[model samples]
Target: MPSPADTLTSDEPVGPQLATPPAISIQDLRIDYGSHLAVDNMSVDIERGVIYGLVGPNGAGKTSTFKALASLLKPTLGKIYLNGHDIVTHQRLAQANIGYMPDMAPVASDLKVWEFLDMFAGAHGLSGKEKSTRIDECIALVDLHSEYHAMCTSLSRGMMQRLVLAKTLLHRPSLLILDEPASGMDIKSRVGLRNILRNICKSHGATVLISSHILPELTEMCDEIGILHKGHLLDSGPVHDVLHRMTGLLPEIKIRLAEPPDMHWKEWLLAQEYVSNILGEDATHFSFHFEGEESDLAELLRRMITQGYLACRVSERQRSLEEILLDLEYDGH
Candidate 1:
């Protein structure tokens, strides 16, 4: 078996070039199953070397959208472009550039881990020495070296997930679509998967589209995010920009008090004109939601201090991507 470093190098291309183009692009994409329209007019652009998070509640059409992009399910309307080639017309060429791992496990329980990866490498047209080398490279990439010879049935849920990822990388596609890749993983396994995704995006220049209900996990890994709600894309953009837009001009702020405050203080804070909402409150601290001119917030703070409140600490709170998405739903969309 080749060393891990050597295997990594083998999977990367040798030459340098400009304008590699977006790994995947979708425009006004829609998919219908019989009378039900699962995805509705969704559009997105995923550039190379970036991890894009596709997040939504269950049955929000995230899986349907991914299937259309992967060419596993044909769209009822609109177009999909893979590396600038139209998937509708040039499906074979387009598919060659994508590796899709569906939500359900795709592994063959009877096959050994190494054999399964080797099978996909062969399907991608690798032959002889090249095929063997690529299979080894994929196995190493997913850190399945120890379990290479183990039967698929014998591996744990996390190990099986790693094997599926290895299969996806066998073809060395520019785009990877993983639908709930961490579905049944434990905390440690989930973190391990996240690290692998980041490294793949940074080192191999692969664009990854990962859909998950775990908002916090997605926030840490994705460069851009798309939030789908009720089959409509509620918001999609850079994480910080989305948060800023949803909450308007008010900055999220948190304050730590030297001692626990009473409910009276909480009520007073919420009644302030500059404060929009109270995100959370506990014995030691409370977080306030604000929206308005920055100058107005400064005035409110001054008033609080002058009113004889200790106000031991004050800092702008950073909204998580999940918070931003939940806030967007309140706009009556």
Candidate 2:
């Protein structure tokens, strides 16, 4: 398969996040439909001022969990706390602390973008100059200043999604819970969403919990990630650590010879036990899977140098989050 070189893939742009008390805490969370359980005994802790991605397949209960958090669905058992308030008991306060944007957002064709934001701002108790000021701030926050006065119905799908996001942020929520926010967005729109969310986490220090089928974008946008499957939380941690522990994934390594080697380099590599799934036989670059001892790679490098291969560079390449997650599914995890 051709690699997604044009896709945004990085853990660097989001920057450093220090550990803090849990902004979101759940214990023994369960949601059931009659006798059917959508989520069972799933628990997770999302830190303050961090963007946590909840990744899973369609039936993995991602949306169910989000609904429970937003107070739209009551849990059968267990507790969820948002910014220190219990969601069940202090429902109104918890809801106030959270800004939830579901997969489908409601935007009126009759009103302009700012008017829609103004309506929500007033509903949230903002009035007079404060409401107007906050509306403008939110419009700018979502990078919708150019369309500030435009009719909401005339916007593109991406712009409409962004407008909904501005409305969600108008109340200055302490926690943001978004489900499939980029569902119908273009590549440029997806990248723009990534940047906006990252800035929100860094500058505003708000806790965010988001899920998207766009795994590649999640890798670039989130500070931590939780993988859920069949209503179970498989793993959760910082992106780099989760990527490393993603099903004992073997990282691919490439060895580049200074020149086309006429010697027996291919034969030597093929003979190695850990060097399986070799990709190419080109004289310049040889790539293979390496799951052996880390020390073995050093030994292999020395041997290659001694064999007159003139090793110019040896580097490791990891598969993307999507690749690793696919393997995880095939393995029934």
Candidate 3:
């Protein structure tokens, strides 16, 4: 299967540019409730056919941004464009291409899965054989074909989430806005949802904008992510790039020796300019922070081997997204 990166670059011609508009663009977006401000001057652009993750803690204005993008809320200040159509003035045209699934969106207990989808399909102006075909296709896309006839209330939380996802896809919307989509999902369900989302972008060229407080989920699933704090966008871009900028790109390096080493090992490691925060687990195990380029790290390993330290294993680990966010919150950023 094609990855989102593959979908982006595959079969495209090399040329000056067609200047294709982004899937969603928000400029100076601000949302307020009476005297309270929710979103403040947030601006971002989502390229087509990518899973863009909106990440923030609660009260970060994620929902307000989604509501404005979905055209369900009027921004106190800002202009939004969906596929080059102004969301404020061209609401119908913009809305016709958006599929929004808010957090905790309810489902009817009396209707069967297919029936629920069928009702939405008709509402989207689909009918007869056309509607039926589209419904079946969406069901299969969300991997709910076997549960097509199951009652809504009989489904598991994961299955119900997929059902709602199928409903969102009924009209084949070009943009998907999902808020906290993995809120109640188990590990298996979350994995399935991730795969399905990747397939959607790869196979259909649909752009997905999903928000979640689950840091590792977004890190693993999103092609790009934006960090929001107190209704402000702190940073946005590729995962590692943003992390590198925010955390100085320092990676913790763990090392293991083939056997117990002489005390000189610690002295030599500390003598290196780029190493810091060195800690030892045992006689032959230790870790430290390496602040250097990739080439420099490789050279340091070679020096270790050349010094007859009998290095057995070396690995690098960056700070997790959760830890980074926690630091941000602690600093009140």
Candidate 4:
């Protein structure tokens, strides 16, 4: 994985976000099939030039919401705007600004990779030299230049994904709505896709709204994420912010003692107001959840080493998405 500094550069634009309308603005969006409600009243605003992830379990309304945003499905109620253009009333303008790629995006079995891209480029109004140059650029962007002339069927599953992604990029749309784009990709291809998406955000200033079942992958790539369950958005924000919002979750603290302490030491540690869920006792190391502020933890650590003379190393960790989501799912039940 790339370091934080490498993946998230300070040079990326952050201010003036509100000066321009959000790349995507969903208002009271709802989708229903007969008596079954697939999506509830979900509202979210995705800023420009950032990757926003939407994740949920099976039948979680992810696809329903995505279709509505892509203008492929008319919501039972609500409005969707892409770059300030209403999807229903100004579809042409809205569609012109977005490229939607669904899971298992198909390709022409008889067409070569470049030919496939060429067709979309022409449809997008490119002509002659411009069309050819765009095809080449998109192919290179996906790292499929090596397979430029190969038959779409001949390409591997991962390569097929790349071909569709290249197709999605032909018009350089400002908003990219990709549903499970990395579904069939291998580890290397997944990494390449992450890098490509980041580059697209940096260079082209495109906002990516992607959905995936893989929670951890989104954690690494997206600037923000929304958790959808049974059509309702449980929470959405930066990873740490969402983590802290979930109940029963706190910053975890691990303590490495200078040596194994007596039984009384456990009681003393439990006496701390902020400490909870202490674990392990057979060794010099132990861990617990801390519900207090950073200053409280620092003071507690100081007291432990100074008064108890048993502490050595103390470190803090944020909970992972898997842990938070599991608690969320359980709580919903």
lDDT (Cα, tens digit) per residue for candidate 1, span 1-333? 223433323334322222665777788888889989788888777788889988876677988888888888889998887776677666676776688989876688789988888787888888899998988887887778999799999988778888898888887777899998987778877887888888888888888999976788888778888878867887888876665555546677888777766667777777888686676576867787777677887788787777555578888766676666566556565
What C-alpha lDDT do the candidate models reach, one value each? Answer: 0.78, 0.82, 0.85, 0.83
- The residue pairs in collision within model 3 are none
What are the clash counts of all predictions, listed in order? 3, 0, 0, 0
The digit string of per-residue lDDT tens for model 2 on 1-333 reads 113432224442211233444788887999999988899899888888999999977788999999999999999998887765567765665566689999988788999988899888888889999999999888876788999889998999888888888888888887999998997788987888888788888888888999998888898899999988878888899988887777464678887889987756677787976788877657698888888777998888887788787889888876667876676577675
* TM-score of predicted structure 4: 0.86
Order of candidates by lDDT, top first? 3, 4, 2, 1
- Cα deviation at 172, candidate 1, in Å, is 1.4
lDDT of 3 by residue, 208-263 (tens): 99998778888889999898888899899888777666664577899999998787
Off by over 4 Å in 2: 1-20, 247-249, 306-310, 328-333
| lDDT tens digits by residue: candidate 4, 1-333 | 223432324454332235688898888999999999999999988889989998877788988988998989999998887877677866676677789999998789999988888888888889999899888888888888789889989999888988899999988888999999998788888998999999999998999999876778888999998888889998988866765665353677888999887777778888988888899855788989888887898898888887665787888766677776676577675
TM-score of 3: 0.83
Backbone clash pairs for candidate 2 read: none
The candidate scoring highest on lDDT is 3
Question: In candidate 4, which residue ranges exceed 4 Å CA deviation?
Answer: 1-18, 247-251, 258-263, 274-276, 281-283, 290-306, 309-313, 328-332
lDDT of 2 at 17: 33
In candidate 1, stretches whose alpha carbon ends up further than 4 angstroms from where it belongs are 1-20, 246-252, 256-272, 276-291, 302-313, 316-333
lDDT of 4: 0.83
